[model samples]
Target chain A: MPAPAIQVDNLSKLYHIGASEQYHTFREAIIEVASAPLRRLRNFGRASSSDSNIIWALKDATFAVQPGEVVGVIGRNGSGKSTLLKILSRITEPTEGRAHMRGRVGSLLEVGTGFHPELTGRENIYLSGAILGMKRTEINRKFDEIVDFSGVKKFIDTPVKRYSSGMKVRLGFAVAAHLDPEILLIDEVLAVGDAEFQNKCLGKMDDVAKSGRTVLFVSHNMGAITDLCPRALLLTRGSLQADGSTPDVVSEYLSVATPDGYVDLRHWKSERSGDGPMRIEAVEILDSKGARAGQIQAGEPIRFRLSVRGKSGAKCNLSVAIRDMMERIIYNPNTSDDKATVTLPAERAIVEVSLQENRLARGDYSASVWLGDAMNVTNDRVHHCLKFRIEDSSLGQTRSKGLVRTNGQWSVQRRGL
Target chain B: MNPQSNQFTSAMTADESAPAAPSEDIPELIIEAQKGWIPIHFGDLWRYRELLYFLTWRDVKIRYKQTVFGFLWAFIQPFLKMIVFSVIFGGLAQMDSEGFPYPIFVFAGLLPWQFFSESLSRSSNSVVGSSSLVTKVYFPRLVIPLGAVGGCLVDFAISFLVLVGLMAWYGIAPRVGILMVGPLVVLTVIASLGAGTLISALNVAYRDFRYVVPFMVQIWMFLTPVIYSVDIIPEDWQWLLMLNPMAGIVDGYRSAILGKPFDWSNIAISAAVALVLFFVGAVVFRRIERRFADII
Candidate 1:
């Protein structure tokens, strides 16, 4: 019965807002203060000052984590993820409920939290370490390692304001990493660094997890979350939506977040909304069976099925895009040679464009469909309507590392004199 | 494994109690072990008193760093005000200082008022000014204003020493009542913190506190008997004005620094109001402290 690393129960936070309901002038304030109870009694039948501005950031959120368990928290924006973290971290008190945590909790909610512009990077390391709840000896023991890890050795003695943004973020992260707290709550801090730096951070976090310290990681990057955390809790619109395996939750999240690649913009929530009658009806990625979904490899065989229609039966040039999660187009299939014309029957038409092998790395990507009139007759239409996910594993279900193990040929040769 | 690893015995006990967390161990159970100890606790504030000291020190250092005249800024403002008051009131208005030199009368009043005004200005905007720290991490929200208010003591000391210099040049000696300077100084600090905390908390919710502060401080200056003696007011009306907490504190400062009588009746009223203000300010601050992270 190892004591659980963290326990939270029946937590709820309620915020009361103010309306124009004024609290009397000075003379009236004195009289109101004297008769507050009487006033309340008189106006008990109706709400007076507050016009129902009570918002609950969390509602009965109860969960616990064991020691050394690295759990990913998956949630949409405003899903109470940040609020839960804040309350647990004690940035603010839970409106109702108690959280019992064992050991110091180090949080990287934001980088460079306490760096004074006038203080040197070296001084800031100690200052931030202390703020993170590390003692002097604790910081002293790991000071050199933190500096080395941050790769800011050259700028360690320079004032923090003088350091580059990367240098500042690195120093802030390094101090947080070396804190050695029993529990760590990190909010996508690795997001600050470059790809190589991010890779290095992932490796370090892997080591942190292996060291048997409990960690709660929150990130919108499903790849990072799925790679690092085995278990995850998903929140939607402020309630616990799903609590299960990382792959399961992420897959669930992606399905719900499937951008309104649907043909009609009104029925669908389109990412790109704009002028005139131009809107994406639907975007479908089908398999050889013509099923709505096709299991995809990063850069392998796949098909794009677009269903777009214009207000009139006129022919329209089609433009399709394959954008990665960061919104960079990984593949675009709207060139002249491979183009297909669907004399859209007035209101609706289906266009299917299939490639022998879809070349993409294993991850989530969005399928975009756009429509314009023939001979440059109308405005351009670009909309991300449907969501597509590339599974690295033939297992197709496991979200293991967000990265797939691609088969590449390699050989070693030696030259002898 | 090391021979003393407690490997065999520890493993056996692990079944009964969590090994990493020593549920039965007195020290291990100090903070709750679930979800990692609540990221913060009210008790933690008491534990981290040294951090508060260092933060206050940081504020003082940061304020003085890279400035041209360094600590002299503390003395320069009050000294300038003292001369201006002495010239205008002592020379032109010819207001009596109860026989003591006019500058001495005015400087003693200005000294506490200046500390009050400076501390209030800094503390009122302290949370908003440090928005970088407030919204992201959790520390006692009280620390920002406390540090800003506490940092003023350094400036107060620097300027207070100048008063001794001015008194020496004037060849005036203080009476034994100077011992009351310590309590009077404390009273002044309490008055400013009470006002600053309440205002700063409100400042976060309504950004209008930014516009209101300098305007309020400007008006507050006249309400207190800084430029003139409280004796200038007819005796009957003095008690009514003493409701402004600084009135008693500023008057008390003049009493201790100069040889004036301790105005106990007025001070008693100010003490009651100051204490009430502090309690009121603290209540307002605590109630709003939780919302700052979300709203601010």
Candidate 2:
């Protein structure tokens, strides 16, 4: 029967692309201020207004959450996920509409927001605690608890500049975890910590949710979203796409993920280094049917199609290396390794690297390509140029012990028993 | 301070006993941001006073952490400046000190001047220096510059001791009216905070303010009566010089520590001008605070 902890009403935000950019000098300020009236008159005269450069980062976003509800927000890049959190945290003002919260709110848009390297770890805990809006007395009450959680008791009195990066993050997350705000807002800062620390952070978040506080968590990690949140909100192009149970919303989000989970690199605009005679313009991952695959299932055959352009008489052989999320190369297929070379005929050639079966475990992977001649002459090379994911299947464990899965046969003879 | 601690404890107790209050009666904070000026929220500033103190402490702690001289560096700046000015202006140019020893006279004037300039330059950069906190979290943004200004008061305190030493070395004895130093220090801080707040806010939008501020401070020092006595100026134009808040403050310091008659009229004018600057700075700072996280 209680009211919702957070209520948002038609919230929106607009960002000017270029025309409304900042003036960074007094000269620029004077010029702009002097011409302001003329500019307004010109804007008024332009009936068609062809030069409108404003983009709505968020549009009419309305949502409400009951007290103690842990909600997850999921979206692609440029989907206004960050803008929404910024508005809620009051980091930036909303252009229109409003949101209401009924209790003390602590937003961890970033961990270690105000940590000074010269301060000791103990001092930084109090300093960061205050920056996150915790009172001195409250920090006093939980000082030991935070230190104990970070497991940096021995180094507590040492300056944080001396602490390892992992130690600093652990200490930072510990301080944030101990914050007892009635409403906690978190961004993707948890992704910075190692796996064990991330697990501890998630566990602490679970406890916080159970302790009857409201939480709005934003992350690109779908696994974490589904694991921690019972309800999820999906944002696409600044509008709420769906809001429902975690599974339903996640499924909805995944359904809209690039068809077959394959990235099309034909439009890849990142700079590549190579000899001017040859260029690899497009790369893609294709399934058995040659369909663009964003994700490939275990035990399925997959192919990488590299579209290359080269000058006449340019001798180039293609190679690709598949790397896991940690950038550890799982496998590499190289024509030079096989003592073979394919010279460019006239202008363009499509190089195909197909795997009989993708035995990769459930994790994200990226493919990089190189072009060289038979003399081991390097023509062009790109690192982690394309990305894709491997999904779990019946053949492999849900989580693999290593990067790749080998279908090695095992049979037990009766004589052993 | 007592009330803040009491509120902290009560808030803690309230958290421990949460879900006990009638849920229907819980207060809701509506956050509809409109584009316009908002009143100065003194309540929010009071609520975040602890943060202000901590930020000031952080500044002070970080300044001397790895330095060899530590707090002695504060004493060295004004002391060295006094020596340099005495050699050039008092020794070479033979500027009159109006009965006080030239070294002690300049030291007295430099004490307040150094504090004002140091506080002004530091607080002007405070907001931009703490941009990470400004862009990520929401508190009274005014706390940043105010806390930075507070931090410089430590340096002032350190340098004030050097002034006392010089006074003793010159055989100048303190008088009962020296109590006025407290009010003079407060006035200097208010003026610094006011101007610093305005500059910091403008620096958020136009980064040129960064380059402008240092040059402005350098010129500002010459305008203040740090190297010479105010009596050097024509009598009628003396009031015109007091328009610079630091001029009156430096004069008051010399009068107070040297047991000279206090310039009550000029001090009154300086205090009024400082107060006006404080209000104007507050208005400008508050007007731009909401947009700092975005613009910065």
Candidate 3:
């Protein structure tokens, strides 16, 4: 199998939780080292050990990939996905084990890693190419292709500061796509950019894979992963759980992810947007029978209840956003859409939204809650606040090719004939 | 097309062995936990030399962009500093200029000192300022600080022309001694790079260095003999004062441009000290480079 394109063995990384936070000056760092013995003596009688501060970001990860294989790495947040990519890109050293790869390696851990805002688009192309390990001659040869691919030919000489964010991302992707390395390591850089550009990138990646190169794709978007990769690896809590066919691995992941088809967000403790005047206390999904349901069948009715609190007499425009497994916003039902603003009392209130017929395909989906005011300002919002699954229905429904399914009538009139 | 599609489908099910990658005798790279003190990888640096150039170009372009003066800002900075120092130290304090006009003498001193100080401060902060680039990609981390120093060299070159004009205004003709300016410029860059690399590496670990640098620069300027000549210092104390590497570089510039006698003893001591500092900085920088992405 051509010596396996890449081989990783017993790879691990260690991180100190709070220790890495207290940044010290050069003098303080020196002083700490000098007083290490004293500090150790002072803490000799402590009951609980201080080892809780240490975490294994990655622990004894072992894997291998054949040449020309496209493998997807999937994991939740803090599952060591980023750490693994960083190690493979050599951005940081591994604390244990090793990774070996054949041929020239190019990693796109971030798009436009070295693009300067002040430099002209043309100059940034060359600069970013060089930063990605492209030689001058190679860039010269592919310069026109890159400019054409970016579709920024008219403004190629203008500084990037004036370019739209989409234009910049397009130009950045163009340069990275033309790297032509033997092994490409890409993180979730495709999560940005417009849909058309993302499709173009996926097409390019398909071409790259067909050209006899290897790819290691890491993303939380299962649709993109399944579309591009034939094999998949699942990582959970810094350990490899499954490495098999894409569908099997992905199903295993989803089944483990939303075990009961729902995640309660009564005490979501992460950072969210908006002021303190409004807050989302809880989110619940109910079935047609008015009972809490984890999974709803396709085309079935579902209800979303957002328990919100605000000052008395304050008005809010409550909304719900539903995203498919690919993390793409498929549906956003907002009170503002209908210009129907609701008034909330000083205490707590429940905002209910009912979906008459859910058209989501058979997959895992996430729902978010948003509370905004009349001024179009988001007063409170929480993302990925609820996870639920849509089970397959036996109504002989025609499968759709998109995130949502819809029924449309089509008839051909023979008037012309 | 139908037959081809059928063959493709059949092949997909028929083959059990993975397809071989296109092989071209490419060597494999093994990445592991690095240990011990490895020397600088000159080969790797050579491979990434283009990135260094591009980074330098980026810094130079970004510095003058959206500015009214553009490159003129380079000249104005040192010229204004020269004028201010000439007024305060020369006119008010009555500092000695060692037989040359105070303006030209102070201008000559400011040329090298400005380059050194600018390069040092820029280099020291380069790593921290580019935390995104450092954390995102893998190249020689030293390129950041080195590129910062390189970008400041353009400013030095621009200001050097103003010094020549000021010397001409004073009717100080060029001499063979001016040839020495080339080596002295190199010495200044090396010294700045040394200190800059050390501080930039430290800055990643301790952000306090960012606040400390400007204050240190102010104090360092008073000690570098930019406004006054080193001859004003007592003879015995001169040796101690020359311990500051920039003292020797400023002295060299004044003597070389003003046609004064070069202080060989003081220049020798400063050159030795600057070389030592450069090596020490490089060592410390290399030692801490691995931890930069993690800590920062």
- On DockQ, the leading prediction is 2
Candidate 3 falls in which docking quality class?
medium
Question: Candidate 3: deviation at residue B217, Å?
Answer: 0.6
lDDT of 1 by residue, B1-296 (tens): 24353244334434523554554332232221133222334575776665666677778878878889887888888999999999998899998788888999899889999999998999999988877778778777777787888899778988999999988988878899899889988888888888888888877766777888999999999999998888889999999889999999899988888877898999999989998997787777777676677667
Greater DockQ among 1 and 2 belongs to 2
Off by over 4 Å in 2: A19-23, A38-52, A260-285, A293-295, A299-301, A304-359, A363-389, A392-417, B1-27
All models: lDDT?
0.74, 0.82, 0.84
**TM-scores, all models, native as reference:** 0.75, 0.84, 0.83
Q: Model 1: what is its DockQ?
A: 0.24
Candidate scoring better on lDDT of 1 and 3 = 3
Each candidate's interface RMSD, rounded to one decimal? 6.8, 2.5, 3.3
Q: Which pairs clash (backbone N, Cα, C closer than 3 Å) in model 3?
A: A312-A346
Name the better of 1 and 3 by TM-score: 3
Writing each residue's lDDT as its tens digit, candidate 2 over B1-296 gives 25575356546655755664555356567787765666788988998999999998998999988899999999888888888999999999999999878999888888888888988889999999989998888898999999998999988988888878877777888998689899889999999998999999988878888999899999999888889898989978888888988889899988888888988888887788888898889888888887887677
lDDT of 1 by residue, A23-70 (tens): 223344466578999979888987785544565767778888998899
Residue by residue across A1-417, what tens digits does model 3's lDDT show? Answer: 369878999999997766544576677778879998888888888854557656788989999999889999987656788899899988999999999998788999887778888888999999999999998887887787788778899999999999999999999999998886678899998887989999888877776777678999999888889999999988876888889999999888776754543454556543355655777887888878887776888888889888878787888898888887667788888888867788886578888888997888877887878888767688787776667888777676546766688878989877874
